[model samples]
Target: MIRTIPKPKKSKRHFLWLLGMKLMISSLLIFFFMSSCTKEGTISLNNTNDNIGAEIADSITVRTATYQLDPLPANGKGIMLVGEMTDEATGNLKASSYFRIGNSAISSVTLPDDAVFDSISLALPYQGYYYGDTSLTQSFTLHQVTEEIKLIDESNAWEEDEKPVFGSGSTLFTNNTFRYDTNPLGAISFKPKPTSKTDTVFVKLNQMFGEDLWTKVKSGSNQVTNSEEFLEYIKGFVLIPSGKTPALTAFPTDSILMNIYYSYTRTADGKKVQENLQMKVDDTTHQFNSLQIDRSQSLLSALKPDAEGELSSDQTKQQVMLQGLSGLVTKIQFPYLHEFVNRNDVIINKAELTIETPPSSHTPYTAPSTLNIMLADEHGVPKSLLTASYETTTQAAYLVNDLSGGTRNSTYTFNLTEYVSNYRGAMEDTKSSLYLTIPVSDLLTKADRLLIAKSDDSLPIKLRILYTKY
Candidate 1:
């Protein structure tokens, strides 16, 4: 039976088997295609530009940026400039090559290369320039050349040196260097001389003498004579017992004396005579009698006694008889009266009366007189004249009574005791002159008022005085 069925449809069965094998082959082919499409590669686009060269072309131009260089360092050293272009070549766009600039050059110079540019335009890996090693990247610009900075030259701060020539511009300071040249301003002064004490004294003494009385005398206007002048005028009168009259002759010398004389009278012609007067120097008992009349026999008799009776009665008797007879005859012969019948009257009587009279009854008379005397030493020491002696002469009395009256008789006696005693006392206590009184009236009356025989006078009165330096 199998045989018979196969035969009828074998063609359809074959068609179906072939269609199943085709379907399996198609499935395997699809699996192999999927595996090949999913496999990984060794070369990456991020690793190299050649791997993605065309792909990154737009980013390359857009990423790059321009840059400027930094100014040079101090002292003309170089400075650096860095930017982004060189960052890509090294796979680090933020850190790239830099350029250096110096003072002498106007442009920036690239490090690791001598390439220079008018201005630095560089790329840096970073957005801005930062510190980095020179080998990595650097750039710099040249600084302009300039003069060095200097300090100010103030006058207060200046200093000097021996090596330099300093001018007016030089400054002053407190070291050994400089000093102040101008001196301070203004003026100067001085003092005067002195005087002496001796010169002052001499001037005062000269002024004193100018106003003195002696100055007037020297000028010849002697209105009144002074004591000094009177003393000088009497220089000749002063006695010099020391024999120094030559020395005393000078003015105001050791001794001086002065004398003045004056005459006083009542009548012009009434017997102008001097009598009964005396004088003594320095109140002495010495009498200077009859200085005008030199003869004084009666005075000598009164002073001395009758020694050896040389004045006895017998001797006196014969003397008086002879003198009386001569006096009587002489009186009768001159100016005689004729009515005398008595020629026998007294001629018989006078000779007889004398012979009858005794000599013992007769007494001698002394005349009154005056004198002034002075004595002094060389130094004007007054000398006493109390014990000194003096004498003078007597004059005859005129008859005034008539003989008819039984011969009116008269007798006179002189006493010198009171005069001597009073003068002795005056000298004892005196250093100068004594005063004497002369009886002008008494002497005139006793002389019968005769013309030449009446009046008495005095002379040359002086005073003795002592002088001493002490």
Candidate 2:
């Protein structure tokens, strides 16, 4: 030992100092190697909550790092990660969520210690790394290592007035409105009835002449002489049965008949005056088969002495006498024995009368008159079998010249006499309509049959009045 070169001045401080320097150099080399290896491999950082409070560690480990891709890389494309680490590294790292490198699609990466990253980023770098080779890429860091989190409440986010309520099993919403329910019982009921008033007037005239030889007048006065006197005139006569003698009483009470006649006499002015002078009973056809008195009997014979004398004095005197006697004589005569059969069952066939007056008086004066009889049952209803007909006659000269210069010289008549006959056997209903039609041919036939002269011409009528139920 004595011979070991004298151990020149060995000290503790120098030995410790040499040891500290050797340790510092070894640590620096290891750190540099680690940083270079990290760059070659893939640097990853945890963007999760744990990184929020983390200081700059020697390395970085990503547990929840989502990426913000500026221009997302297409499918099958490789993405690159780039940022400065806490260790002061600035090169990009090959790592992505949608794409991966060989054997590290979901692998964990370790970064070098002492790395400080300023702007970290990721992107799709190569093609054919994503499905369909799409161009989607994560190009930026979606979260920072230090960040604060926030929570939101979605309740009451929408206004109450704008919100809608949905019923069970229904997606439709309803608003505020009123609806009504309608059913059969909600319908209204209405009924109609007759509420109109009826206005009508009826008239009946009865006449009597004498007790034993009584005659009832069928036709009423042409004009009302005086309202009081006219009423008395209608009731002046009483009806009586004719004598039983065969020759004296040829007219039977059960038969329906009519009579018509006219006469002419010379007036003081030398004018021939004509008028309805006598009436002779016959069948309903109105034919003059029987006379009230024999035609040969003098009409003056029945007049008073003064009247007879005046009539026999001269032709002119006779005309004056007849004219004055017309008012006293009844134009229509019916014996009391010829009473309407079944008085209670009798029906008024019709009760219409029309008069035609001359606009100006002239020679061959012609005035027309019409009467319609409508037979009805005891209840004032029409009967089917009761019929009636009309006959019109004019003076020969009037027929030849006055009426259209003989163009309308024939007759104008109607046959409605059979419309009501058997009056007792009719329906009881009062609501019945009886239509009366005077066909053109039927009218012409009656006109021809009752024409004053047998001419080959037809007459035109001036007026027609009809009475029937509508």
**Which candidate's TM-score is highest?**
1
What are the clash counts of all predictions, listed in order?
34, 60
Candidate 2, residues 1-470, lDDT tens digits: the string is: 56656667758999999999999999986775444222321222222123212111211111110011011111111111111111000111111111111111101222223222221111111211111111222112211111111111213322333221110111110111111111110111111111212211111111111110111111222212233433233211111112111110111111211111222344456554432212111111111111121112333333332111122112222111111001111011111211331245232232211112122311121222222222323322223222333324311111123365533333323332222222224433332222111221121111110101112321121112121111
Cα shift from native, residue 322, model 1 (Å): 22
* Angstrom error at residue 268, model 2: 54
Alpha carbon lDDT of each predicted model: 0.18, 0.20
Q: List model 1 lDDT by residue over 1-470, tens digit each.
A: 35554546568879889988888888875654333222212222233223222121111110101110111011111111112111111111111111111111101211212111111111111111122121222221111112211112444332332111111232211011111112211111111011221211000112222233223332333321343342232111111111101000001111111111112342556543331111112211110010011112321121111111112112221121101000000000101112221222111000000001122222221112321112222222223222222224221122222245533222211211122223321323222222111122221111110101001221111111111110
Superposed Cα RMSD, model 2: 68.4
The TM-scores, one per candidate, come to 0.13, 0.13
What CA RMSD would you report for each candidate? 91.4, 68.4
